[model samples]
Target: MHMMLMADEKRLCKRFFHFRIAACARAHLLRRSVCAGFLTFLIAAVFCLSLFSAAPVKADDKVLRVLAWPGYADADVVNHFEARYKARVEVTLVDSDEALWAQMHAKGTPPFDVLAANTAEIQRYTEANLLAPLDLARLPNTRKQLPRFQALASIGGLTSGGKAYAIPFTYSSMGLIYDRKQVAVAPRTMRELWNPRYRGKVLDFNSAQHNFSFTALALGYPHPFQLDPTEMRTIAHKLVDLRRNLLTYYTLPEEATAFFIQHKVALMFGNYGTQQVELLRRAGADVGYVIPDEGALAWLDCWSMTRAAADPPLALAWINYMLEPDVSALLTQRQGLANTLTAPVESSDSARIVWIGPVENIQRREDLWARIVSGDRSERF
Candidate 1:
């Protein structure tokens, strides 16, 4: 009987290892809430065990292809997924959302089977029919996710025509990162980035979409994503002011971190927020992060399968494995990003986080932003 219990536990561990100990899953575990799935897992495990008590045979030569932002698919996470499922995992990192879109549509079959993108970007992918309808049956661990994330259809870009497309992954607010040693007081508003006191010491992300939207947010525009042409002119002038204040605009999180340390940056528009915080702290910098009174812009990134998925079941396995407590916890511990499956002790929830959405006039914003950065005066807009 003891041997049977031990064997059953091992089997159960394999089926639900990701959720058995995570904060998001622990709460549900204590409530005896996973009984239904647990039963299903037990039956499934028994069937698999009947095949072999040793490692399962690799079914095919297909590799599970993945495209994601940095820190999402750490080495250990991929290795574990590969080992458990007897499949190879290939990962590609995308720097920006625009880059991700270009890659996704770069021909017939994408180089990825699964990809991570925010709600706003996924809306574009879904609209373009570049994604495959998610088969929830294959990813039983979806039950282990946070209740808020479970309703994928409710999110703008995740579902259409009664089919789910993505699984909520990591999220973070692009808040303010101020140098505590240099600045005596923490900044309290987005408008403070324009303060002349930090001239030539402030860093902003070199992204047209972010700057235009951030400026609108700073000006108290009702919807930062949807702006009128007149609003564009007003925000353009604000960008010119911000441009004069900035030491240099950054492209990637790593670039922002390196600039912060090398240039003695006093303040930064932390596009990656805590992820950037982690990178800076690792480099031995004293920085303070905050979502100012005006609120911060946030992105809800999720995992979705591409229509060109090399192996659909294998792709779903990666998603389910990622939802595991250990994998999700690693996101907070390593990257400092919030996991959808677990709440970090550092308070992932903000009173005001303006999640990103599709913006109006993509070309116009890019054009005007270029002009502003190229020393275009306010009148140019």
Candidate 2:
């Protein structure tokens, strides 16, 4: 098992290297080389199909429907699966866990075989009995995953029992993206965001999750996920207090990036996905990002197989395929997030600061965030 896991890791690292190379040599690949690579991939697909054609039929065989974020599983992934298994995929895009839960309840039975949601939301779904037991025997890739990831998947720290639930997918962290030319130094702690130095020049997330977590960290809270009533009150007051100093509360990273580029803001709370910081640096804005020492919040999005999956085997197959090193690297690289199947490649400086590791602390985040948004408490931080 260890050998297999290591092999997958090496494969992931190698593929990540190729992705970096490809990114740098995109122009060269574009003119004529890309066609040859595509042809080779197609030929490989044909060979895989022939090899698997004689495999015994499984009990669960049908369209492997999935609910995921937009642009998650791309064309190559889809084609690889369809050609090999001769199966169909029906995809539905969802933006939030609340929306996903609503769909499950409204449908009575889950309409999709596989569901993608953040690590925190999976807890809610599991409690609601909306998910099925994940058979680890079927997911060899899970073993090669990082220890922190395994801890996140475990329910209260038990491996096997907890393992029977969700498969770890991708992860990212909340960080500060700033215009370096406008700021003298990067803030090492969440409290710096409130410094009068950046007052009215700070962009923030309007979403309850990021907003609340930032305050919780600034207040020296032990864990964002373990917010008590007093902690919740403190967070609410802090946000209300910061309102006057904030330039704008943004819902999307793009909006925050736009503000920074336009010189409307100097620093903003941002996640790992943006090319904004990089672009700003190149444009002479002196920009960069940081994962504050206050212990930034990290999130993992996983693939949860619904209990009512109409095609269980096919769904499992898709999950396994996604665990493939190269495939996982492609998704993580493009999406700007980390996942179970791949490790962070240091070539991208953002990868070093991007959020990784266990999500056990997230449960505290959810509750504290809820309190702040609901206006349930109003004490000063």
Candidate 3:
């Protein structure tokens, strides 16, 4: 009996070792396959494990394809995610929503599974039926996100069917970035920039929508995104009043940063928490970013999955992984941008307002911006 028991014990040990070895191999293979289809891979792995008692898995099978803003995803992010999950990620950058939409539409295959776009483009993509609804159950990190961000990710229109079409990534309020060395006392209101003392010494965003919204704010009308016809007209009048004082209106942050470095502009309106602030500071520019009492127009960017995605599961995995506090924190910390992750590593009231909050009635101003840019509203200026 003793000999028989000894033989049984040996058999059990061998079986256990075999199981472990197989699991390790499977883990590696699954990582490669699902890295791009993050959550989808997890589900498929479970199914595979149940079927194959001892299957070899390769790590390279899991490369997630991602499309985001320049500087949003870097080698560091890819390394971290890949190391943790044993997967790889390929990232691409885009400049504007129009460009992103056009590319995806033209390709039809949505070369990437994930895309990053602003709120306006997010709406446009969803309307064009080029986006897919996000699977919230697969994303545990979504629970950590704030309420306002949650709303932004969901489509409210009946045509949109109230589905969650995107994930809120980051946002910034339109505020002035000033050189502390030049302006010992910062201007308290948008109206202050109108003073002749700062004429031809200010930089602003070239965006018609953003400027229109800011104009509404300056006119003491409701927020630009929520403007009525009367408010729109009033804001239009305010914009014309400042045309001469404006040195130049710029779209990219780099343009403004250059001007600030050269002392070409004493004050410039910039997006809060963008890479520009960090870059300017690194260059030894005494820059101060602020959102005055008038409250500034807010803009947000989001992560959207393409409807033509080849591996929806892999895309879900990357989305869920990015929502993790550690991941979100790393992204925001490096980029100097705010994320949806609760209890981030640091905060300022300015960053807090821009990174968090509802759309805050900004869509109302879209038409206003179109009119202004087309010269239809030029008379008001």
| lDDT by residue (tens digit), candidate 3, 1-381 | 999999879756644543453354346446645775877877799978966874455654766778787666777777787787666677876654434655675644437788887766677677778788987787777778888666643433212565687777776566677778767887677676677777667766655556666666666664445556676667666665555466555555655565567645777777544566776887788787767677765567777788867778878877887787777776566766778766444444543232222233444554555454333434543
Best by TM-score: 1
Task: State the lDDT of candidate 1 residue by residue for 1-381, as single tens digits.
Answer: 999999879755533432232233235334544656788789899978877875554676568888898889888888788778877787888888777877776777537899999898888788888899998998888898888889887778788899999889888898999999988888888888888787677888867888888778889999899998889888888887676567666667877786788778899998898999999999999999989777789999999998888778888888888888888888888888888887667884467888888888677888887786555555556
lDDT of 2 at 312: 79
The superposed Cα distance between candidate 2 and the true structure at residue 375, in angstroms, equals 11
Give the count of colliding residue pairs in each prediction. 2, 7, 19
lDDT values of the candidates? 0.81, 0.64, 0.64
Ranking by lDDT: 1, 3, 2
Q: Counting only residues 3 or more apart in sequence or on different chains, how many pairs clash (N, Cα, C under 3 Å) in candidate 1?
A: 2
> What lDDT score goes with residue 83 in model 3?
80
Regions more than 4 Å wrong, model 3: 1-65, 79-90, 106-111, 144-162, 226-237, 272-274, 344-381
lDDT of 3 at 86: 66
Of the candidates numbered 1 and 2, which has the greater TM-score value? 1
Model 1 misplaced regions, further than 4 Å: 1-60, 107-110
